[model samples]
Target: MGQNTDRRALVRDRFDRAVGYEGAATMQRVAAQRLFEKLQERMEGRVPLRILELGCGTGFLTEKLRNAWPQADIVATDIAPHMLERAQQRVGEGLCYRIMDAGEPDVSGPFDIVCGNLVFQWLEHPQQAIARLGRLLSPGGILALSTLMDGTFQEWRTACAVEHEESGTPDYPSAASIGEWYPSLFNGGWETEACVQTFSNGRAFLRHLKETGASVPRAGYRPMQLSALRRSLARFDAQGSVVTWRLAYGCFQKPPRAGVFITGTDTGVGKTFVSACLVKAWEALYWKPLQSGLAEEAGDTPTILSLTHCAPEDCLPPAGAFQAPLSPEAAARAEGVTIDPASLALRMQEPERPMVVEGAGGLMVPATETLMMCDLAAQWGLPVVLVARSGLGTLNHTLLSLEALRQRGIAMAGVVLNGPLNPANRETITEKGKVRILAEIPFQADVSAQSVEGIAQTLPSWADVRGGA
Candidate 1:
């Protein structure tokens, strides 16, 4: 407990000097620019757009926000007084810097925008912070923010765990859970958008966190010993200092919103099967924007239709299907077919029924030269259901896939575990892996037509399978 306080204080002291910190300024500037661009695009010509930033740190983001909206009134708040002092020094006019905790933001008024960068993990009650932000925002106002996700510091965590079993900690919350925290946001009339970004290594990565004043420990969290920390750092060095972080960014718009986008784990994990089941249960139309590795006639759309008993006319294929059993890009190239994601989306768009579209391969798999499956999922904006094979090795794969989807800001509708059940694997995946296995489909010799009927009979209802959807 004492250590936690000291660590927090040390972080506060480090960040107090962060505004004047050198070397890392360039990276911080670049990140700040990207964030500013996103906020600027959202703000448009709204005169004097009111902007509120939680945990403004040394004011890097706050300064960027001020520059982007010189006419806007920006209020930057942080729990660390020294950090707030530095932030005040950085931003003179149109920006107000205050020392305030995000969990209990003591600012006034319904702002046009609430923005924060890499600050959510330190809070004990992020959902409450989000709800407070929601209450603070004016009608139609949006909350644009970014934070360190579960995969962040994975290398460091692993290294620490070997020497000190209890030292390493669990990853941060999934973006889906973060989204689900505010059920009222969706059903109570609000539109939300979220995504995650992954970073490559530890020294430079940790340095970035410090520079941005985002390295503060949680309020009541314990700290590891110095010897263990040194050993962990040494291990990271031995491993070529490979480090990674997952950052989730999101924006929630108040009222009068459209729909949400959905994405899942990797390919052949039953995304299509579960999507078909969802469609049948909801009486929704089913669509597959792009189908790759089609066995001439045995395509994903057909398989889904057969499973759901949808009409043949409802089974839409890709704009250009290829015979080669390769990735969509490679397959299209082999078949000399132009693969346009937009064209494929246009071909699959249905005006009636809640459309369930299946993606090809994993989130990061390239569809075209420039687009990935995740890019398409983000573009479409549907609530996603990730399908994972129900067995060993799924824990890592599911977590990684969830991390990928989170980074892309895709809304996941929970996970569906297909294939036979393995008790050990399921326990590890759900407990240690921190993923909810919504449903488990036992292994069977045939997922084919002859046995699909039997499979359907055993299959649980969509809502029940999806854990009440």
Candidate 2:
């Protein structure tokens, strides 16, 4: 048999054994819980929310959804007949199961919500599937999706590649790269949001993929020697056998209104500071679409509140906050938080005010395997105001940031230069760059309540610019 045929047969056989396959691990349960919460939020009050679950292997998620919303009309579809049968057996009335290929999923009616968890990677054409999914949504309906990114099985791929020449089989696409495929969702009539997350190491990681039936066949590739596999496993041992996974989660609304996005030149360059400034200046609602460090109450949101003197209710954090003081993916690994970008967007949509959103780190910082902060910005369709320092190399950082924003097609409101003014650098930033210097905040000896209050004086009247005046 051909490789494709053999692989399909293997997948079908695995589906047969996977019947009634409830996820056995606490982590898998936790992941399921997160996905459920996201779906609930998106479908809230939209009675009879028509939902379609693609690749519903073993119906674990379908059961969870049914329990959560008995009123929901869910169609659970899978390519594997055995998987569809298992799903039918598990789900009671109000749920429908069908055997269907995800790459070319065909179903009736415009669904209010289209969900595919850990399924996109297995398909031959994910982009086409996503576009088809978009078309499946009802007007104003949402598409909440989660997929394993390219970094999912890095160690295994590497080991297989070195030991076996054909071992480095193509894995799933990255969230960042995948974001490129659906620009119309953001740039045109749709409003989109996306995020990326990472896990610690290989065993736990592979197990999650297995439970979801997301494993790819290694046939036609160089066969892995047992010794090499053992050595690769050893490398993951130091990291507690934790394999990192990247998931791109996002929501796409059919039609979007005006929104705002915030970007920064580099970490510690004051994206949060400027976000807070804008919130205060505009009295806009505040949201940190993705937050990395949750330990420091003195971190992003707190800083914004301190600067703006806004009540705690004014600022909102993302769905998942990592305890580690690093990036979202890294912090999530340390804290055992499964970061899903679509889940974060659902959490962030609560606040109704003109929003002041603080991004984690700089523009390209990975929020998931396939997505970065800039992608999230573009998804929100926010006219961005870049935050940068007024020191040496500010010009370079600002220019690169602007270039990235331009590449992403994000509109720029202007730039905010923080810290003590370096005359030459500031001149270049304003004069040579030919970009508006929205504000110039002088360096403060102490970033205290008083210092923050003083700096607020230098801020331009954002109310005029931000349309809240």
Candidate 3:
């Protein structure tokens, strides 16, 4: 038999024997709760969605879904029949149960939402499963899941080195790999938030893995030699030996209704500031596709990197970086370089992952001879998050910007008012522009990490962006 076939049998047999799965699986249960909580916060006050949960092990998450959305149609499934039976017993009413594999699910769906908790690690081909789930979603539908990432169980691997080489944990994908994969698979907004959980001592970690029914290695069971265990124990820190579970949870859609495009009524209007805040808040990748001014510490990309501590790759290098602090066209001309709209139209490449793409200037700023920043945004098909000043003259600039965006058929995700508060301007812009004010950011005393986080909290719920339809 093939590796994947053997893995399937191993996974099934292990979970079938895990009768105390629920009692032992505390971390998985907690992570599932967190994933659902985020989904509720993101989808607050929206209509009840038809939800399909893959890998519904023993119904811990299924019960949570039932309580959260009693009116919504939910179907839960697992590869292990014994686990499915337990889930069926626990979730009882309002849920359809099945014994099916998530990697190659037998069910049919145009589901509003497809989610799975701690399930993707078992799949032989996670990319294929994600593509399958993408097809199952209705247009504007979301597919959310939590899965183990590449670095999970690092300490255990270190401790039991010999056994690990022979029979280690399943191969988990990296968060970066997942983020990169989405662009090719779906045309929608996606966001990945990563976290690490630490457990004291190797034994406790091993016990936790068993209780969660995640103890099965890809190659099947292999006992660690007692000598190996003793050697591993000697490596623990004074505090305790630690085991880490690296997890990535996220939400994405197939055909995006919206994406967050940060542009301001004018340059130096805190567009970069607001973009950084959104990047931190959503755990999104940052892109400044056309950086006109080239300065070491003054570029928008640098400012975002400083604010969010994002990886350098996550903050993409611009397609055109000119020396002059002028519009993309003028700057390109000054530097004896040509800027092409076709070259700048790279946002379409990865439609699935949620990203914060900062525009060069106001809506009508030109990227090329015929292509304005607004045109670029419309081409990308992302919603605009218009940044405006909150004081005098803002109403006019903001309204004019809004009109320009509307004329280009670009959707406005919302307006973010920057600087000192001016209730009158805010009210006038909201009333006249007919747009929602997502956030009214106060004057910041500093631009440190703590300050940025505090400011991010004030922004409207990210749910409002919803890949602007």
Candidate 4:
């Protein structure tokens, strides 16, 4: 009992003393971003209504979670009160902050997601804590984490070995052992990223570790004598030392739920129009994960609410809102940022009320440098409701989009067409694409709630659409 308390105290003190942690914590920030992206593989189409984060030191990871899901109720906790204070300062308002440890997390449950970054290595019993975290999840919820793993700090270890001294770096779990940490009932998986950081010399390297609160070794680790420490430092500097931080990204899912992704055959293809019709028709919730042109036009959230007359709360805000009237990738780059489509993943809130997720641009459009709109839709695991124009070259555009969706194995929630009804175009699309048309409505001179309701009346019931999907 005394040893456990001492370990906890030492860990807390280490972080509490790290006053300049934010600037020096490059590894932590990178791990947080990668962890955020990695989590989407396990949890697609699930919007977490509630999220609990452990060890949110200085809020680097906390800030990412908040930006990705601004609508979620996130609670960020840490072992050190000083660190929690810094986190609140970094993330500002709208998040719940607490001074709590991940080893013995104290909070309510049924959260859609529970996560931590670089916290498990400090736990007294990491595997047991993971099982406890699993118990806190809602049925279909996930517990995601990124931790420092074994084989870290190889350069420092080698230098110490050459100098006949003990290395201060803590021993971490192997990838295979981390795999065994998941409970028998939970479905869990992990992958690793090798991040390299080069320092001018051994002294600067030690300073970086101290500033980031990662200098603390294991409970029983012994410090080297002054002579030995100096010899090891000289050896490290002579070897042109480079530090390696192996981040193990792990996610454990309880189960999963559902949602629908709305995309277009091409840009300006009535995606918002069909999305609003669905929202008004099914009385569903609305979410547009990526929104560009905010500087020039009225955002989709307001448009959906105005047309559907749904409660403002029913329409969750976009994960990313960029200023330029350009593609998501272009706009994000303009603002010195990049959009990750995986950041759009969400756990379903109310199973009864469906969510209409509208995408920016068409299937082949890029959300990031590597992630296409079709790729995002597939990662979300939502059956897609493709929106298209009713005439002209829609035959080619619609068929191409359908082929892309099919290639990714994304389920079809059918199609909705805009503009004047062209029976020939509709027939050709359905016949060639082998897909159903859910609705075909005339072009609206002025879109309003009444018009949206009228279009809704023409569409089939949610059950019918869902069954076909």
TM-scores, all candidates, are 0.51, 0.49, 0.54, 0.56
Residue 27, candidate 2: Cα error in Å is 5.5
Best by lDDT: 4
Q: What tens-digit string does per-residue lDDT give for candidate 3 at 269-306? A: 99888898998887788889998778433688888888
Instruction: Give the candidates in order of lDDT, highest first.
Output: 4, 3, 2, 1
> Order of candidates by TM-score, top first?
4, 3, 1, 2
Candidate 2 C-alpha lDDT tens digits along 397-448: 8988877776665656678888886777777877655557778887666666
Candidate that would win on TM-score: 4
lDDT tens digits by residue: candidate 1, 1-469: 2124555466556667565453455444444556666666655556446888887766778877777678878888876787777678778755677777676777886788887776666655777677777778764466776665666666667787777633334347675665554412222111233332333444565666667555655445577787767777677677777655565555654432222233455656766666665555555566666667776558877777777787766666556566777778888888787686668553333442345667777778777878887777655545456778877677788888777765665555566787876787777767764455656776656555545555555544544532311
What candidate 2 gets wrong by more than 4 Å, as runs, is 1-10, 23-28, 43-45, 157-170, 181-183, 186-212, 226-240, 256-469
Worst 10 residues of 3 by lDDT: 181-190
Candidate 4 overall lDDT versus native: 0.83
Taking every candidate in turn, the Cα RMSD to the unseen true structure, in Å, is: 11.0, 15.0, 19.1, 14.6
Better of 1 and 2 by TM-score: 1
The CA root-mean-square deviation of candidate 1, after full C-alpha superposition on the true structure, stands at 11.0
Deviating ranges (above 4 Å) for candidate 4: 1-3, 257-469
Better structure of 3 and 4 per lDDT:
4
Query: Residue 380 lDDT in model 4?
Result: 63
Q: What overall lDDT goes with each candidate model?
A: 0.62, 0.64, 0.75, 0.83
